[model samples]
Target: MLGTAGKGVGGAVVWFTGLSGAGKSTLAEALLPRLKAAGKKVELLDGDIVRTHLSKGLGYSREDRDLNVARIAFVSHLLARNGVFVLVAAISPFREARDRARATIGDFVEVHVAPPLDECIKRDVKGLYERALAGQIPQFTGVNDPYEEPLAAEVTLDTSALTVAQATSRILIKLRELGYLEESELARAEAPGNAASAP
Candidate 1:
């Protein structure tokens, strides 16, 4: 369990890593609101948002992707250290980079969002898989670039079988098991005058 000085509240960095259409972003977005409603300070750092901000000029090369992941990891670490939960949904394909991120962020929890490739292609919200298939996008992870999965991730969710709510529940259960939230917290949240009372 992690500890914070004075407040006794610790922050966790939940990294949702997988292929492009693996539902990482969707799960992260869904989980963020639930976490916030539970009185937890949470931030969602989606890959597309980070790519637009920190990695504006970077291309799809392996080196650039590594750098982009590193940058996001650094920011996530900083926020987590300040007692804010950080949710990173990114296709961090390299094992080394993800390992380095775990080392940098002490309370990092790697959640592998592994959906079947065919299922991902079938639910191509951004048409990335189609573009990759058409040779428009080169060296795509899960196509050309390798996605070295974590050997010992804290949580693994197969979105092909799990709905968004189910996946979010799994993550929340893990967070509770890790002592990130007390069992009584949610009950207190429902009580009147509590900070997390529903609107």
Candidate 2:
């Protein structure tokens, strides 16, 4: 129940959901190094990365989005079941899809990264907001399309109020609190001979 007990292999699936350019990927990137430093086995399955691999050729239609989320969720569940902690940074616009992922994955934590719409547009890393506004792209997640907010999430980061580092720290703290990192394991990892050991 706490970290990896015996050779059973404990894993966590963290779902970071937010609008594009809302710092979901940014926070996940920041969190990765911290977790690695702490000797945690971690992997990030970002939306853009998944799109290139698992969700190729998927369009912006609602049905396509559903399929995309489903594919990502399946792969994520497989990874988690094998004892690799996974971080997913995707818009994942529908609550139904997210719930399906949770149902499939045994240990899942949903983290909502909520940034103001204006701020997301201003930060538009891919220029998607501009294209959506200009009618160049339709059915964008937060533009013409819908984003169903999670009714219950393990954690919610207000990116508008927190720096990326702060957000990452908050997530790590939550993971520790949730027994993703057992106290005994963390203590052992910090021991002199074990400090350099990898998870």
Candidate 3:
């Protein structure tokens, strides 16, 4: 279990939940280099990548989805226990499943990448929304299935309204508030010209 304080910043799992096109992956991708540049050991367990490896056999049924999430949570727990920050960007539509993950992780930060269903559909990066609506896909979350919004997430990002940089800025603020990022490191990540960082 990852304690509040440890030999280092103590590890954490920052879990991002949202609809398909909710910018969860985009935000996670944007923040990863920032975290790494701050000299932190961080890993991103992206949903699509998880599906390819950890959840290859899992189907779209609620039971299967929960299992998939549980697998990711378990991996995150193990990694976090070893002092590795795990950033998970999964749809993770069920509240119960997400709560279970929170209970299992030592230090968990929940960030909801919120964009309305219509807004998500409008983005449609993979044409998933169009396909799902056309009945090409079954058991799609937020289409025929449900998305249980988080009531107590540490932070909520309106992905539709804010630029990725702005949303990432808010996330850095929250991590600083939770003691994950030192003030100086947070300030550097917050700065605009820091992408010149080598690592």
Q: For this target, which candidate reaches the highest lDDT against the unseen true structure?
A: 3
* Candidate 2 TM-score versus the reference: 0.86
Model 3: colliding residue pairs: none
Q: At residue 42, give the lDDT of candidate 3.
A: 88
For candidate 3, the 10 contiguous residues with the lowest summed lDDT are: 1-10
TM-scores of the models, in the order given: 0.88, 0.86, 0.92
- Show the colliding residue pairs in model 2: none
Candidate 1 versus truth, CA RMSD in Å, comes to: 4.5
Query: What would the per-residue lDDT of candidate 3 be over residues 104-154, giving only the tens digit for each residue?
Result: 885889999998789999888789878888999888899878999999999
Decide which is better by lDDT, 1 or 2: 1
lDDT (CA) per prediction: 0.81, 0.78, 0.85
Better of 2 and 3 by TM-score: 3
Of the candidates shown, which would achieve the greatest TM-score relative to the real structure?
3
lDDT of 1 by residue, 29-103 (tens): 877877777778889999999999988999878789889988998888778888888999999999998988887
Give the TM-score (vs. native) of candidate 3.
Answer: 0.92
Looking at model 1, residue 137 earns an lDDT score of: 87
Q: What is the C-alpha RMSD of each candidate to the true structure, in Å?
A: 4.5, 5.3, 3.1
> How many steric clashes does model 1 contain?
0
